[model samples]
Target: MDKIIIDTAQFQRTISRISHQIIEKHASFDDVVLVGIKRRGAEIAEMLQKRIFELANINLPLMALDITFYRDDLNQANADPIYAGVDNPIPIENKKVILIDDVLFTGRTIRAALDALLDRGRASKIELVIFIDRGHRELPIRADYVGKNIPTSRSETIQVRTEHYDGINQVALLQ
Candidate 1:
């Protein structure tokens, strides 16, 4: 069975709320970089970037971080070794990076993203922003900013559909 947890209106409100939270925490976005995980994460980052710009009138640097090797579904034995995504080579030395993602399940993806970030440059600090926190973390990682918390069982899955990918904006729970 599949159920819609969040609709389009809620999605817009969530992004606005999250944008306000980020602005509240930072007096200045000069050294702050918004790095979204590829695909959905990247799309959310763009949304936040636009929202922040509209609210604060200052544009923050945005980048998409692709963790092909970090994902369990794509990192199989017979998987392709090539990373097809474009490489974003922005120097993040001593900068505060706000890592964005769609969901927080196993912390392995975050760990792999950390590795990729370090390879780019030594960040002063890294804060996480997850659109959904669905529990069941395999590691100690946690999101600093969460749009929503939907506790899920191991047999279930949380899918966040966006206009960029699924032509809709909503959160769906599938079992």
Candidate 2:
């Protein structure tokens, strides 16, 4: 796969800024839950949780969600099949949920995530936080907090690596 480099330093700064923004908007992490989509999204959520605690001195609940089976394109030939599992139980009934993901591509993943989350319980509100927001959304979903926006073709992909998962932190353009 062809690779293009994205500045790691800049990405960290963006994440820090987003964390601060989240804290500011909510004013407190009292009723906030951070739910990360499986794989890279989970890693980002962990980081966000840490940042939130560091910034606000509040320990927010963190959960991981797998929306692979709920994907609309699951039956497609190119859809990479993932063994779905719910690692963390969502216990935020009537609390605000901040869904975290590494990248927002087609927006279908977010839709599936919502379905899975609702199966567990209803949240007071659901906010989206994505590391990368690429255009060409096929669904009406939008992120509440985004680290970066990179416009690219549908054939391309954005790969995010964090120290929690890959032992490094970076974002790359892949083809």
Candidate 3:
């Protein structure tokens, strides 16, 4: 069966809450930069950026990251890897780096993201923000900011759909 975990309204609310949490912690986004994983994560990052701007008039810089090559299981995966490139022009040194991803599953992706991220520049702090944290961690990584925590099994899949990327805004569980 398939289950709808988060609908459009919930998705919007979650993004707003995440943005507020960032604002509360940083007070100002002067030294903050948002780095989103490729595909869906990029869309989420854009939403958060806009929400933060609306809330505090802060226009945080955003960078899109494609960790296709940094993945450890890239060779074992059944799909051809593609390079979409990363958008990081601003100096990340001594700045707060927030890595955004649609879903945090095995933490392997986050690990790869960290590797790709650090290779670019050294930041004072690096935090993770994930829309859904469906636990099945193979690594010791964890998200600093999580929109929702849905305990899931290995046989299930959690899909996050966004209007910007998927033509829909919702989170679904496929079993």
Q: Which candidate wins on TM-score? A: 3
Query: What is the C-alpha local distance difference test score of each model?
Result: 0.90, 0.86, 0.92
Candidate No. with top lDDT? 3
* Residue 106 lDDT (model 3): 93
TM-score for every candidate vs. truth? 0.94, 0.90, 0.96
- Tens digits of per-residue lDDT, candidate 3, 30-80, equal 799998999899889999999999999999999999999999998998888
Tens digit of per-residue lDDT, candidate 2, span 43-127: 8888888887888888888899988788787888485686768776768789999999989988888999999899879999999
Model 2 stretches astray by more than 4 angstroms: 1-5, 77-84
Question: What residue pairs clash in candidate 1, if any at all?
Answer: none
lDDT of 1 by residue, 112-164 (tens): 88988888899999999999999999899999999999999999999999999
Clashes of each: 0, 0, 0
When superposed on Cα atoms, how far off is each prediction in RMSD? 1.7, 2.0, 1.1
Error of 3 at 137 (Å): 0.9
Candidate 2's displacement at residue 46, Å, is: 0.4
